[model samples]
Target: MKRIWNNSWLQKGLRNSTFMQSKSPHQIDPELSDKLFSIVNDILPPDKQVKPRTGLLTFGDAPFHISQPNQHDTKAEFEHEYQIVTEAMAGLRKLVPLFLTREDADQQRTLDLLRLEFDAKMQQGAPETPIDVAIDLVRSVVADVGGLRASVRIFIDLFRALSERRDELEQQRDKFWNLPHRAPEYYARAIANRLAKLYARKTGQKPTSGASTDTGDASTKFTKALEQIFSLLDIQSGARPPADWAIKNLTEEDLAPRMSVLENLGLGPSPSRKGLSMSRCVLPEGPKD
Candidate 1:
């Protein structure tokens, strides 16, 4: 966050700076200043850049000498510009995680923290999370400077950039998912443990005797754990049945539509009919008993 300075402190700082020491009021070369301004303007986003305006007068469609504001107005304008710069810097700092490389530990930690914060907000039934608030603040800042049209243009540009980088973004997402804690088996084990606790609370009975072994194949262990959970819940009928019944009754034809729905929602990969099967694609294969 930027520190707020009183008018006296700002005046003191200016007095100490070279800007105040210059003998001539216009010590800086106007052409050089204009060139530097143009360079910086070109580098800045459209929403942040200063727009050129017509001078006080024009001759043959060309701008004449530009008019300068009063000293008080110029001071206020400079303070406003300084405030905008500081706020933009603060916002960029908060968004550092988004720009970091996938392998950066800081990026991972920041993302985990954000996810936890988002989950906490959701659990607390918050109307707006911190992320949402930050986004709205940025939109408001852009709109304040360049109006609603600029905000829309900024979002449209962002969407285009994301669309162009979809494949790279997917690869980064896949990398994140491949992390140890994000493994499928890890989630399955977590779900099983939670369900076991819930079952104990509901039935007032201890969980099954033999817990799923960690040494065996992960898929086998996951399957066994799921079986134990289903047994505990006594779900012996309806759409969710035992593995044997599922293998016999459910086919690619039956699951294809659901897979298509997932694909459409961008939750799963594109559904492939050729390699689709109950055991391979839909369910974990293990001993039936």
Candidate 2:
């Protein structure tokens, strides 16, 4: 029988097979995968991590399954499908935060699994990102319940409480950009959304606090937002001095920078400057365009 080489919307994703082949699960040291899974598994809710037959977040239409009678099955196809299945689980890692936030017994185990998958996907180059998607979905799911504010606040929680981790997330975005069609907008939109949450977390009426005033380890979403807002504004004003966040409030325009690229990625501090710095590589849309 002749093989049919048909393409689907997922074909673009399939093109990302190079990402999957690089880190086949069997290649992962069994001891390490076990140890890591054990640690994260210990902290998560029992039965939550189990890949259920169905759920709110399922691979409903994700073309990870392809059964063909005409074609000979090869390792490449098998590996690609495996990559799709594994890559799609990217969001479950963020369940680590859910479990950790609740201090579940299996928090350690869940976190370990998350770390292992996050690292493996990154190293393998597949960029199977469930964390990013999960957060976005959470926002979507919450929006109906809390309206835009809930969505906005969750974003704030992500940006400010975790702004220090922005560097790592940006690196993942850079990796994803190298994939098919090169979704630079994916990075920008994600960053902007997070920034918006960071902004709303700050200056907005709502409040969430971590750490103690007595300990002087206070971390309010406000501080992170201000820093990011100033950086974004600086990007817009052609590298103006970072605004004195000491002042009262900031507007969206105040946060808008020229193209607003820096905060979109690399808001994490760098040695090149006291504040954010770009990764220093020309994207596809360089000056030649």
Candidate 3:
């Protein structure tokens, strides 16, 4: 009897053979593997670290699986992991401005398109938290790439590259001020004027050039005001507000009275709450096309 080769099996075997030939040595030194793992752990925070599966033989070229902490392991362990995740998300939120001001026009456009998709997802009642949105974005990208591990590896590599070139990235970000996308100087002046007004209102006197005010206290107040403004505008903290909603229109006095009324009614000035109304505050009609 003549033996015939299966076409699909032959193709698959060729592909696998080619892949193996192109890959590095099948086995890695145990010490070297451990050192590599240690380096990765040192580079990434706990939440972003990749863990190797124990009791399994892995080749040098094997893909690494990025796993989330098992929530069912223990309540204390879960809470600890939760805290790390929260801190990671907060750190990510702080990086939003840098992410938005990409030096490459293509990257900036890609991010803008992603934001549009995020907004559409939110409108469809997806979880509105930044963490949830981030997860959704990751899932979408993973799906597009056809492999979670590959997508995660790309992200990890990009993160490591960014960490190594933080200073260069910051310099590039500074150059974004010259771009016509947004006005950073105008916003800086607005924030400074607002802070000065708030300082004067609280102290019943204008701040002098050499006045010795508590720097920490002023910083805390400034942070709170910025948070409140972002919350009221239904935008992220580092994001630019809609052009129609002039920053000049939303004065401290305008919000102060409304905030007091909300406080009296056991509500805060949150865009999410039905109690808060744009009409109550001195805001423009709405964002234009």
Clashes of each: 0, 26, 0
lDDT of each: 0.35, 0.34, 0.38
Q: Which runs of model 3 end up more than 4 angstroms from their true locations?
A: 1-95, 126-289
Candidate 2 per-residue C-alpha lDDT over 11-33 given as tens digits, one digit per residue, 9 for 90 to 100: 46655643333443323344433
Q: If scored against the real structure, what TM-score would every candidate get?
A: 0.18, 0.17, 0.18
* Model 1 CA deviation exceeding 4 Å by range: 1-72, 98-101, 105-110, 122-125, 128-289
**Residue 109 in model 3: shift from native, Å?**
1.2
| lDDT (Cα) of model 1 | 0.35
Ten-residue stretch with the least lDDT total in model 2: 61-70
- How would you encode candidate 1's per-residue C-alpha lDDT over 1-289 as one tens digit per residue? 2232357875465456533233444233445345434533442345544333433211111011111111223435545644554444344323422422234567667755765554443333322224233333443354345443343334334433333234333333353333543333322233344333333333344333233257532233223444544333343322112222323433333333233422332223433543222122221111134
Clashing pairs in 3: none
Worst 10 residues of 3 by lDDT: 62-71
